[model samples]
Target: MIGNDVIDLALARKESNWKRKGYLDKIFTADEQAMIVRAENPTLMVWSLWSRKEAVYKIHNRTAHFRGFIPLKIACQADGKVLCGGQFYFTDTIVTAESIATVAVLEERQLSQICYLQDREEVVKKEGFPYRKTNSKPVSISHHGRFEQIVTLTD
Candidate 1:
């Protein structure tokens, strides 16, 4: 039972001005802002934090009454791999297991003169009681624009 998520830093740089600022104030808190970013155009930093947040949040939905983005953290190094509070690292990679396994990919990239997203999700449920629901639903959302971002997800 593992999950990962990603977002385009370039797309966010070119596309969003309002959602960047709006979510900054609305979704992120003061400590979260201070912890991840110390820049003026904090949108990209915000998204970086967000991509990690969503990645982990997908695995464990928002159950912590956290006032800010809590499950996501990034190292202040060159490779900003998403961290899940522990030694967990999240990046573009693939892992395999013998039991049940699942994977999710969400990304936005700029190719040539166009920007697009490649989103996919896969679930493998092991042999268990079918009544309890052990498989995750694959979520894919694609958009075409200079920046294609998942604006919102209601539950």
Candidate 2:
């Protein structure tokens, strides 16, 4: 499976003009751009969408060749979600048929908001919960979802 990891340029490195625009078009769909217009700085908004798209690509296992994927018709949504790449759609409709997303914010610490839209739930950060162990080891050391979720992760 393919995986992609995106970081906020503001939190990592400065982005060049070409990198910003190129990635903006490469990642977000038209409707998504409009929905995120509150940000006066095109850079930050694009950056947020970038993170979400990257996460979706990872979940969809299309990160190996993101360019093969297209927005809207193939793998992007207006409300900040993504489908799988078109190239593999016929063989694997599940990828592009559903939506997936992840978001990262630069708060005091690096906070990542992971969303698996197909599951109709988001991966959120959780704390202060009873610890469950599996195989005599910590099951996981991450957060859980607030909304009803069918899938979970432990790492």
Candidate 3:
């Protein structure tokens, strides 16, 4: 399975105060919190990790048949590997001045097959999940503030 998430930095900064007391604790593990603290850009790190978790959560829900956002329950390593129910999902993340985007796959090798598309219209809904219309490849679309990402797999 494939999944993705995106975060717009400007809007995030305007909307959330990540430094607020207990916010990091509520969403991150102790180790994750440490990473954020040590990061040169703590704000970027927080959202990067969050986007990774959100991307992995999409795949987790498909296999586990569960719903809801349980951030701490899903653990993410600094290397973009996410642990959910003992299963490992690998993620590829992009960080820019304005946004952060992440794409996840069940197998690490699948990461190489991921393709980011500029055409949003290629996406269609199947059982409420996104997919590419031409080849029916699973598509993950995420929009936040001014940024959006459309991801799919090839073969």
Candidate 4:
């Protein structure tokens, strides 16, 4: 399965104060927090890790049919893998001046393609996954602020 997330840096800067007391403790593991503290750009590091966690959460949600918002529980390691509920997920992060994007897939799934979409509805029409057919290859789409990204897993 594939999952993805995007964060708009401009909007995030205007809206979030990740440095506030206890904010890091609420969402990041101790190791992650240390990485942030050591980062050259803490804001970008925070959002990059956040995007990765959110992406992994999406895949966990679909596969386990569960839902929750425990960001700290999703441990994102420095090596670009996420650990949650005894499962390990592979993840990738992309950081641009304008945004941060992350993609996650099950450890066993091979990613076939990655693309950007201006309109997600086009996927339904183009891929013929009207109800988002689960039997079909898993694809994840995420949009934030001005950007939209997708990750697809192949057979």
Candidate 5:
């Protein structure tokens, strides 16, 4: 399975205050928080890790068929990987000035393709995996603000 997430940096900057007391503790593990604190750009690092965790969570939810919002329970590494509920995931992150996107696939699965779309309206209109012709794999898609990202997994 594959999962993906995207965050608009401008929107996040205007809306989120990561410096708020207890915020990091609520969503990040001690090791993750340490990485954020030591990062040259803490905001980007925080969102990068957050996107990874969220992507992994989506895959977990799809496979386990349950929903939960315990962010602190998801452990993320600076190198863009995640562990949650004893399952490890391979995560890849892309950070640009305007957005951050992350994709996660089960560690045991092989990722076949990745698709990124900037046109939110078009993505919303299409509304499903649009790259199946090129790669017949289960895909997960996510969008936030101006960014959209997809991750595909193959047998």
Candidate 6:
């Protein structure tokens, strides 16, 4: 399975205050918070980390049928890995000044098999989750402010 997320920087800045009291503590583990503190751009780091967890969580949710916002239970390691419910997911993230996009897969090697696309017309929702209409491969779609990203795992 594969999952993806996108975050628009401008919209995030306007919508979220990561520095608000207890916010970081609520969203990040201690190690992740330290990473944020030491980051050159703390805000970007926060969102990058958030996107990674979210991307992986999407895959986890699909497999586990889990529902809820349990951010702390999902951990983001520095090496593009996410740990949740004792399972590991690998992530590839693209960060720009305007947005951050992340794609995650169950196997590390599948990272290269992720296809990013812009054609939304081929996407359809099945049971509230997006999938490719042609092949029915699980498709992930995320949009934030000015950015929208679509991804699917290729055979």
Report the C-alpha lDDT of model 2 over 52-75, residue by residue, as the tens digit.
Answer: 554444434322433435444334
> Pick by lDDT: which candidate is best?
6
* Model 2 regions lying over 4 Å from their true place: 1-4, 11-13, 18-23, 62-80, 85-152
Write the number of the candidate with greater TM-score, choosing between 3 and 5: 3
Cα shift from native, residue 67, model 1 (Å)? 17
Q: Please give, for residues 46-89, the per-residue lDDT of candidate 1 as tens digits.
A: 55455545544553332222344443242322243443434433
Instruction: Give lDDT per model, in order.
Output: 0.37, 0.35, 0.90, 0.80, 0.77, 0.92
Candidate 4: segments with Cα more than 4 A from true spot = 108-118, 125-135
Candidate 4 structure quality by residue, lDDT tens digits, 22-87: 999999999999999999999899999999999999889888877888898899999998998889
For model 6, how does the per-residue alpha-carbon lDDT over 65-134 read when each residue is reduced to its tens digit?
A: 9989989999999999999989999999999879999999999999989888778998999998989988
Question: How would you encode candidate 5's per-residue C-alpha lDDT over 6-61 as one tens digit per residue?
Answer: 99999988889999998988999999999988999888899999988888998888
TM-score of 3: 0.95
lDDT of model 1, residue 31 = 61
RMSD of 4: 3.4
TM-score order of candidates, top first = 6, 3, 4, 5, 2, 1
Better by lDDT, candidate 5 or 3: 3
| Candidates in descending lDDT order | 6, 3, 4, 5, 1, 2
Candidate 3 lDDT by residue in tens digits, 55-106: 9998888768899879999899988899987898999999999999999999
Q: Which ten residues in a row have the lowest lDDT in candidate 6?
A: 111-120
Best by TM-score: 6
